[model samples]
Target: MRCEAAPSATSPPAEPAAVFTQFVVKLYSRCNFGCPDCYVYEHRDRGWAAQPLVMSPAVMRRLSGRIAEHLRSHRPERAQVILHGGEPLLAGPPVLERFARRLRADCQGLTTRVDLLVQTNASRLDRAFLETFRRYGITVGVSLDGTAESHDRRRPDRAGRGTHAEVARALTLLRAPRYRPLYGGLLCVVDLEADPVETYEALLAHEPPAVDLLLPHATWHFPPPRPPDGGEAPYGRWLAALFDRWFDAPRRETALRLFDSLLDLYLGGTSTSEMWGPYGSDVVVIQPSGLIEYNDVLKTVSAEAARSALHIGAHNFDRAAADPGFAAERAGLAGLCAQCRSCPVVDICGGGLRAHRHSPDNGFDNPSCYCADLSFLIGHVRERLTHGVSMLRARFVQGRWSA
Candidate 1:
């Protein structure tokens, strides 16, 4: 049975057509940590090695101009500029401040809201860096894999030393009364081997406002690790266990983005993140050298999968929107495979992340490697929600009859 290509019952209101709303600017091309699972460093893409170590003043100026032009042309109600890296902090406070100030000045009076954010490994976040972030109103999102043992296993420093202590210290600072407002949240890549409940407990220790659990970037060509003894859907079971723990907690301490998205979908609401739903792609990335590209996760698919002829030095946002890769992402569900079109949860999963469906044999015309897991998790959430609603309805009737 083929599912029709219609908006989900929970789909959000349509957004205005815009060239792009999120600009991910790569401030530096080198990272301080050597995370084994980093799509940029450990994946097939080696393009980063050839780029300039840091974004130059001239390139930043050009980027600012291009972004301002894009905003003025499209006039999206709001926009966000994300400072990404090899470690955005590696660019130092002075450089980052200049970039932020330039972008804000250029877009002044154009965008209704301008948000600034920095995604960091958090090891280098000290008092000085926090002050700079505060001055610019840039929220800090830290990447830490659960507990020390689980985190240090994959994320290490250049000298091969465990960075858990440094990350922990940074987390402490981020959660401090003064800096807590700047703490955006925690982003943890799932380590299948780690115990889900223990990992959840460890992450909650820092009291992050939210947590985003990400599936490690993988494609059909280089798939994620399989379960032992050919067991089916290990990742699905793992996520489900974590969902139960989060749902059953006496009080919801922190927002788990994945579970929250799933629950929202099941309850007839659209997803807010690119990881799910039928939201059109509204993000564009700028390399340190001024090249325009799709999402960085495309690096995991192939070395050149993310490479585009569009260069911010020459092309404006309109030219980038014309790029075939960008067009494909903008196409949304129309770009999904037939298998996805036939799936019952097509509205919820949105054919998974585009990069995860890649293969040498069929390009991206395939469902994600995590398809089974997504289906299982979504179904589990829907069932639980349906049962809960039924129970509430029954109690309401019983109370009326007794009265």
Candidate 2:
């Protein structure tokens, strides 16, 4: 594959390098499970309804070849490919098998690592699926909320019954010694009403390697329900409690990405995802139709799915990286708020996730939707550490004086 410099002169400086790390290929727009809160279907956009049920083989081939050529030029070896969708498992064995094999074959000589990952609801995770995952060294992330009651409320089947029991059974099969290594972790959406302890306990029973807690999506236009006047909403409170419990828990078993990002910000680091800061450069998503898009959130911005085309074929990665609009959006992370710019802890906070920062009117240049919750949690964590440091210093002084 031949490589060419970006035609646009608005390329970023060389030192920081491109952070284009992951590409989520929407393999299908159809899913077997029906979660009441799914953004793809439940949101007002209704775009997924129009997308083809599955990615065409021609588009997939073009995407795979294009990505390989892009990697050859850009050489960001850590770039990953996630088989995303209504449910990636909906592609079944033959499709996934071909996709993975072709992806691996296309970029054989490049130093970059192309990880094949599947984000599934675990409904169709039978022996065949597990076998495919193992064969390709694919990491499988299953979406399961907490206990039956909490999980059932939001994540249900098309028939209106809770899918918790069925998902759990599938997960158990995945962990049944034979397929344990292929399992990545559990992806759970936060339910504000459920007790944090109870939810945590329920999830811990399953022993997934990691747990990702996702906040529900809403906007100023469609703001999440708030009290009549005075009382605070339960969403932030629930997350705060979970953070507290995770901190106080006897053993740390699960890898919570949200908490990890928060901790990174609190400790003065930028987040890996656009959600945490103004990071605009390092990410990209490949749709089933062979187009390159920024975070999938941009789908809400335009009805023409083809709006984000930087370089459509297999070789546009670096060119997209050099886009002026992309750079401006990324730099916008730091200017999120006056408070964030001057805040003592802005490095770690990164002004929160881009999705939360997005206001239809303001683009992605605003404060987080969970600004209150984030500020509250960061304050609490800071205080705990500061007090601990003071106590240790006092003890040291006392010992020296006594001696």
- Top-scoring candidate (lDDT): 1
| Number of the top TM-score candidate | 1
Residue-wise C-alpha lDDT for candidate 2, range 1-403, written one tens digit per residue: 1234554567654354454667788888888877877766766556577667777778777778877877776687488788998888888788888888888889898889877789998888899988888888898888988989988888888988898888999989988898888888888877766787789778878888888887676554555555465245355567777877777777787877777766676666756544454454455776666656666654433444224545455446666766654554466545566766776656656676555566669665566676676677667767766786899999999999999
lDDT of 1 by residue, 1-403 (tens): 1123555889875554447888999999999998888999999999999999999999999999999988887776778899998999998999999998898888888845778999999888999999988888999999989999999987999888899999999999888899899999999988888999999999999899999999989999899987676367777778888888998889988998888887787678877667788665878999999999988889998999888988888898877886788888877788998989888878998988998899999999999999888888877777777787999999999999999
lDDT of 1: 0.87
lDDT of candidate 2 at residue 395, scale 0 to 100: 100
Q: Report the lDDT of model 2 for residue 222.
A: 52
True-vs-predicted CA distance for residue 205, candidate 2, Å: 1.3
TM-score of each: 0.93, 0.86
Task: Please give the distance, in angstroms, between residue 57's alpha carbon in candidate 2 and its true position after superposition.
Answer: 2.2
Model 1 TM-score (2 dp): 0.93
Segments in model 1 whose C-alpha atoms lie over 4 Å from true places: 1-18
